[model samples]
Target: MQPIGWVLLILAIILIIIIIKNFQIVPQSHAYVIERLGAYKTTWSTGLHLKIPFIERIAKRVSLKEQVVDFPPQPVITRDNVTMQIDTVVYFYITDPKLYAYGVENPIAAIENLTATTLRNIIGDLELDNTLTSRDVINTKIQVILDEATDAWGIKVKRVELKNILPPREIQAAMEKQMKAERERRAKILDAEGDKRSQILVSEGLKESAILKADAIKESKIREAQGEAEAIMTVQKAYADSLKMLNEASPTDKVIALKSLEAFEKAADGRATKIIIPSEIQSMATLAATLKEMVSDKNIDISPKSEQQAQTTETNS
Candidate 1:
């Protein structure tokens, strides 16, 4: 109702509002950057925090939590002059709130644009095949470069990744065809190699088998020759023994004649069923002539003693 009381009431209301605004409750994994008169001042962390209300204002509030930023695809030309579209993602966190707010204007946009430029530059220096295969190496290089660049902005680049790499349709088809042909060529080479090895082994085995067969034949021929030699030696020894026995003995003519007659009788024993011989048959003219010629010498005798033997036998009977 009074003017003084009204002024006091307005001041109390202003003071309460200031107090409420001064005390800031930041959530976990978050930070606030306080600026005094539009200049770098201090940093606030999670939980209950206080700031100079009238003199200092929160210039920028940044999350200390890890964050992911997916950058838009950028077109890059490889060393082979092939154009490709590549997309990337980056993981970062605000380590120093004061520096994050004051060190750079629009820190997130700066990071994204810098990442796109660096990726394009790096990939441009490589061939299409290298780009597709060496993604990890590229990612690490990009992360290191970005980490160094963004260090002043208080942004810790945790990782850099190439989300997708899309070559032209013709390039994709060409790569597929090349891969298929490579696999087929390798398969054919392996098959040929296996066949060559198999043939070599088979040839070696056949060669060894032929050698063994030849050795067997040689051994058999040697044994046969040895046996034949032994048989010939035996035959020669028998002939020599028989000749020696014949040369060692000499008999009278009568005894030789009697032995020949006995040999004739023994030879005819199994010839026919029956035979008839007259007494004194040995004195026949043909037999007498043959014996007289063989014993023409003075010391030989050709008398027919066989006829006298027969006559004696008859008288006794």
Candidate 2:
């Protein structure tokens, strides 16, 4: 081969090598920023792409996937003049590769600084108590502001989270003390309610017991009175039955007179102040007195000597 042909063959081989090397394959969820002669040209998406060896260059390779950045704690002052340290996390993704390549010198650092600034501004409007409790509000406000501000830089802010908020040690101690006191107060109220309920239960039990006792006593007295009344009724019924049987017998006059005499005798035996004799038994009483006189005279006996004299006189006559 001639020397000139050899040089031209070597040049062609080098050009083929350069062209092969310049062929780019953009992967998924990635973008390539192309610069033509040190000027922004176009962005390359996920595909096979070609670039001029000397005129076109890849300025930047930006990831289109979601990304997260955790910023360091930054000092912030609340509306109550309370100082605190707050850290944050930002979720973002590149929306425009061209802007991302040329918009900012350091995108991560710019985002961090922007996050810190927005956080301070938002926190400065809230008091310490609101700052501690309004995490979602703060996150939303920061996200909205960051999304708007970072739109020019090709960063789409998806979410902003307040990772941590640290207050002064003395303020933390005071909060803990206040929480403990509140818990204790609630516990005391519960105890008082429980005690009140117990006392009410005890009083109700006593009241029920007293009522039962009174009812029992009333029932016992009622039973005793009923028994007494039944006994009296039984005795009266027996007496009435006896009187009815006597009336049904149909006694003769003599038997009736004798029964009257017996009743009069029973009345005489008692310690009565006065006794009234019936006219029908008066004759019977007189006869009974005469018989009693004769019996008394006959019971007398003569002496032995008087009896012998009486017998001698009778023989002489």
Candidate 3:
């Protein structure tokens, strides 16, 4: 309630506010660059930090997390005097907050300019074709150079990528035409190979068919020959059996003569230009004619007595 007591309480409140403001808390993946008396002091990492209110101040707040920066397209000349525009992307992280805060006035701007200059130098050594094709080589070279150059600035270049390489319209058209022709050539080669393979398969199939046909023919001929052999054997066996049965039957001379006559008759029935009769068959026919004439004569007796006398004469002859 007194004036001095009120003034003392107000001063205590102001001091407390100032002290609390001086107690800084650095967050994760961040650092604080502290300067004492407008000179280099120390870097504060992620934790509670206290600084003198007017003498010690935070010069810069640096993020320790990886950062990506895409630089604008820079016009460059190749070894072949071809002009092109290429943009790049860089990945970096802060390593030392103190160096980053004091080493360069604008670190991002410095990196962009450095990247453009390095790109031009590298492109100057390569032809238009090599520059277009060798992306990995160019990226590695740029990353290495940037990492070394940015060491003093407390930055580490992790990766460098050529985001876009824009060539002239004419060059792009020519490349597309060349690629189309290459694809056509490969397609023709594949078609030719397929045709050749199909022909080989057809020829193989024909060869197999021919082989099977020949085998069938060979088998048919072999079977026909075997059948012919068996037929001949059967005919010969039948003829031999007939001869055996005939010999087993005992017959008189007249019966034998009749059988000979039957055989001669069978031989005469064929279409022969010439036929020769045996002398014995001719004599037997003459005797049969004489017997027939005697049987027809009226003076000759036709009884068994005459028949017996005729048979007795034939037997004696």
Worst 10 residues of 2 by lDDT: 308-317
* lDDT head-to-head 1 vs 2, winner: 2
RMSD of candidates 1 onward, in order? 14.0, 14.9, 10.4
lDDT tens readout by residue for model 1, 183-260: 999999999999999999999999999999999999999999999999999999998997577557776656555666
Name model 1 segments beyond 4 Å from true.
Answer: 1-3, 178-317
Report how far off residue 190 is in candidate 1 (Å).
14
Estimate the TM-score for candidate 3: 0.64
Candidate 3, which ten residues in sequence have the lowest lDDT sum?
308-317
Better of 2 and 3 by TM-score: 3
Q: Which ranges in model 2 have alpha carbons more than 4 Å from their true place? A: 180-317
Ranking by lDDT: 3, 2, 1
lDDT of 2 by residue, 201-239 (tens): 999999999999999999999999999999999999998
Arrange candidates by TM-score, descending: 3, 2, 1
lDDT of each: 0.79, 0.83, 0.84
Residue 27, model 3: lDDT of 99
Per-candidate clash tally: 0, 0, 0
Q: lDDT score, residue 188, model 1?
A: 100
